[model samples]
Target: MQVTTATEAALLTSREIITGEELGSVPLATPGAVAAAARRAAAAAPAWAARPAAERAAILSRAAELLLERDQEAMDLLVREGGSITGKAFYEVHAGAAELRHAAALATGPDSPHGPGSEPGRETEVSRVPLGVVGVIVPWNFPLLLGMRSVAPALALGNTVLLKPDPHTPLSGGRLFAEVLADAGLPEGVLEVVHGDADAGAALVQAPDVAMVSFTGSTEVGREIGATAGRLLKRVVLELGGQNAFVVLPDADIEQAASAGSWGSFLHQGQICMAARRHLVHQDVVEAYTETLARRAAALRIGDPYRTDAQIGPVIEHGALTRIAAAVEEAVAQGARLVTGGRMQGPFFPPTVLADVTPKMAVFHKEVFGPVAAITAFADDDEAIALANTSDYGLTAAVYTSDADRGRALAPRLRCGVVHVGDQTVNHDPALPFGGIGASGNASGFGGRAALDAFTRWHTLTTSSPARAYPF
Candidate 1:
């Protein structure tokens, strides 16, 4: 692939998530510059990876402190990036700080010992060691937190990182995070930030010196990255697209499920990968649930994301609105009823609810990263499970049922990465594992211990005394 070198630097511009006005631009390392930085990181990787675990942890700890000290500045940048509403800036910053702190703890934590089944006098240990250089690509949605999830753990384990944040929105998140690491006494080139479009991301993914790649974005781009990494025989962890389902069983409280479902479908203008888009309701209560969901969705406040009272803001960009509109229109054209919303006022697409959706409609099968809820009424538990699992994408699914035994029995039957019995599908925790299955990407989870594992390789070591008799 040809790299762009037309300008000395690349400019990344984003639109305000509330006003639809341009938020100006931030300068980023161009593809050529990114390659140079990757080379620098490659040269520095071995030395960085050889540092003592506790010492490595200290840098992360300092980074976390610096993040807190500069909280306002960090949150300001995120708002300017416009990927998240102003109301959400606090959560992103807090989550990011927690990730850095957790990584520091992981670095200084005890090493893993061999399991109890080992033979006597044969000392064994399983240790996770850093990959030389990690190339990370973060999506516009939740850039600071998701991007740092890979960066913090990888660095704690002593791997150098070259991050390529989404061109639409980069700085004040991934770029800013790297800068803070520098302020915290991290050596230069250990964490580099390169910002651009797909070309820049591809350059990082294909870099021969990079030992592994961690990507969080759509499944289409993930497939390309995964394939490239496979060819190179390099380690890769991907968090891709999600078409999560919010299933309300017969025993569910319609009012409660309706409120949660509305929020789950419209949060962040429904840009989240795990945003609950599919609503599978039992036929017995579908009418009542739809009315409640529509009412709650209609009550949402929409305006500038920076406003404290704003519950729903503009979609990330005008193009996002167009895509969402097209999907909803197509579904409607195919006979799906637009129960609540299907109109866009500039970049603002109001909370939408589509009822009587069928498996054949685009709104049901395709992942719509917008505030459009596609509700399909099902006949029984078997049909609900079938409808929920029908989508090619299976990242998360939630079942709302009062009966514990039934919910437990049905949760696992859904072919998804995670299922919540009482909660909505749009839940995320920094300490738990997160990722998708099937087209949503590989089984590699994106947070907690699994995140650390994704960025590192495990080495099993065994030693025997002279008296030991065992095959090598």
Candidate 2:
């Protein structure tokens, strides 16, 4: 990996999520070093941007190939460092590679078009220009794919990037990218990994040389970064938290709805931003849905992610596990029923289902990033929509119904960035623009053609054959 290995004042130790065995430690970059990295990226941006678009595209394409070539290693890193199950880890490898390939296409995509000027003998054209230096701060949930969402596109668009990954998953989130890119022949200093916590992240956002910052994490942290970037007049993209709803209409198939809801609530142990935190089901069928969901929750096998039989794995850390347990306890105290799986075995939290959950319960309104599905009953469509839209978060939502047209109609009414009909909330595509609104984010999305807009600014140029004489 090409990460900064310089020994410094503080150190971040990486441990296996399941075993808690100390794997390694890396020196943490101070705020001053982070600023210096930004300056270095700024200095390197020009030469990188000056390269032909095809050459830039070629590098990204090769980076994708290299990542796929090392898929097993990358997947293992994700499973060990990021607590992703083997299947999810494999998904990360391919999804991350897809993001790189998508960025490669962006590199050689058509330029902005020219237009006729208002006056004769005049020509006008608009072009997209890089932001110079970009700061990308990603969280640990799906580190590789999330990091690639910002890093690959920023690099492909001719800007140098300074990546700051969450300390907990540094290897999968940051260093792995550096290794793959370097192997793919990326120029030195075009991309650098600054490993630290809030200190390093804040430094990168406030660094004068960084023209833009793309952050994915908690809403609280995203708000702080937004304020800092605003004061500094830097461009910012924030993809924050979500308390997304998995709505089951009365007409929905109970079996299908329960299965989809179970996967949505418990996949990756429900640590995803788009994980279905709330199950808003119609009162007519709430009982059957809850029972089936609880059965699936109880059936999931929780163990080491490396184990082929383990469907659920350990959470990121003890603190997160504690918070998750506390949330469930508080919900039960507030009159929520624990249908099944409320306990933890070591670091593994088995899939949990909370029935009779009311809005008054903390788990009903707040996001508990664990394998807990809080179920609430709604009397009708209006009530279901109201309950679904109750949260301040608006990242993603899912609607389940036999009638496709009815699901489509209700999709728009739900307040979220992406709504899936007859599917789970945790879904991603590098070719689709993804983001959220309200406390979730500021709606500066990522992926596809939207990536071009996120990483570049428009520049207009005008030309005339001859200058007109002034009145004076």
Q: Which is the leading candidate under TM-score?
A: 2
Model 2 TM-score (2 dp): 0.96
Task: Compose the digit string of candidate 2's lDDT tens values, residues 1-472.
Answer: 1233444456677878777667666678989999998988999999999998889999999999999999999998888887888999999899999999999999999976656568767778889999999999999998999999999999999999999989988888888889999999999999988998788998999889999999999999999999989988999999999999999999988999999999899999999999999999999999999999998888888888776568998888888888989998999999999999888788888899999998877887788988999999999888889999998999999999999899999999999899999898999999899999998998756988779999999988888768667789
For every candidate, C-alpha RMSD to the true structure in Å: 3.2, 2.2
How do the predictions measure up, each by TM-score?
Answer: 0.92, 0.96
Measured on C-alpha atoms, candidate 1 has an lDDT of: 0.83
Off by over 4 Å in 2: 1-10, 112-117
